[model samples]
Target: MAHAESVRVVFVDAETEEEFARTELAPGQLPDSFEYETRLDLGGESWAVVRADPPSAAQFLRSGSLVLTLRRIQTVDPQEMAYSLPTIFDPLPPTEDSTGSGEHFVIHEDDWRQAELVSRQLAGQVEAEMRAIHEVFRQSSRVVGEGASSMRVFDRIHVRRTPIDPLSTEVSLRRLSELLPVGGRPYAGVRIGDDPGRVVDSFVIAADPLVVYGQALGDRVTVLCLAPLLDAATESAAGLEQAMREFDLVLADWCSGRLLDASAVGAFLNQA
Candidate 1:
């Protein structure tokens, strides 16, 4: 898995570009169409300026439906963008490690049967943790403002409980259509979790006789299941954590740009 591209994508509704620019983060530098202000180069990737075009005014009335759009007025010089098309993959046994990017997971180098067991167990844990988060947060509210004189920060934080299901019962190419939106298909293989079951909605990542799903439509949360094919792994539960570490070993290359183009894309495209 390659690190995300440095090329910035500008998003907008099917509306006037000038009108959109006024609402942007660095109104001085970026164009709503051709270029967007880079958070690293500039200051912030202002979330305020970039928002999902509301499906309808009514959606805003009931917590807006998030529909994002990316518009390009000019092509990003792939060179200038500094993103890699190369891909790195996790190998089997002795190499797997436990490295996660928060609520994210991946599984590598495990047999299909072991992958199944790993996926199911982690799914159960995620479900239970989600339940616990909701139990503590949902249906609870607090007095936001304290003093009358001082202006409050941002009122209150009302987090809604969005209960999600297992990203997948198992992994396969056919499932990419379901994971990504139409046109959101990924071109590479992505892995998550050190153990076998972290069924996250990411791209088809490459790593030893892998069992993977494709594309995420840019979802960053990595609460995914770790799963791989059957032939390479054994049915032994005793070495679960070790297998996960072996998989984790590949992250450095992935982060540094060794994992993007590793797997032959011919296999994936054929499935699509």
Candidate 2:
């Protein structure tokens, strides 16, 4: 597989021309066309990508360096906003069993709403816990106050589904096993569901602080995880150590499924 190249998108204010927000887009995530009215969610605010400087600069957004000028907007169309945002889930290919039975795995709109609610709740809880933990760390002189800004908790989650095969299973297991041991913790692991023999795999993705896991049943796969935006460049040695300790705590809960078990969304998915 070809390596995916990411583009750094810089969002600048239209009025003051000052940079307000920035984010990195994974390869294939950027839209082919940059519409003038395309609205983006930046730090919970809706900002429209008005235009690119020189107009021709828009073409570079997909392949090379990119800059976006955004104007704050009062209201956004739901459909337009949905199109502007990065896709949360990609359609899974039809499996042999699904194709043969003519019964495809369908995700309803309500399912997405439930998932988003769960994600928001989890993010809130995480932020609160981290703040409290940071306070303790500050008092103990383990980390500085600025270290708290190194990690960002996201209010949204990303879900992806793919075909489950022996090759994919082996690859997933191997990757999980290879995760560096943190604080002498056991190697990350996967779980199996007995009801229908679904494989439940969970782990943090390399290069990001995302806690990801999913369940695969009858060839239908659904992976759901929260994306915790990290500013690695801003991390100091003390900050990095503090962040790692925080991550270790969360990863342990995530791998054991206790993290999701405490959420209503988890209950819904479990029953579904």
Top-scoring candidate (TM-score): 2
Q: Report how far residue 164 has shifted in candidate 2, in Å.
A: 71
Candidate 1 residue-wise lDDT, 42-113, digit = tens: 133323233444433333223412233433334466433421211122232222332454333244332211
Q: What is the TM-score of each candidate against the true structure?
A: 0.19, 0.24
Candidate 2, 185-251: lDDT as tens digits: 2223232212221122323222232223333343332333332234322222232223323232222
Candidate 2 lDDT: 0.37
Candidate 2 Cα misplacement greater than 4 A, ranges? 1-4, 53-58, 61-63, 75-272
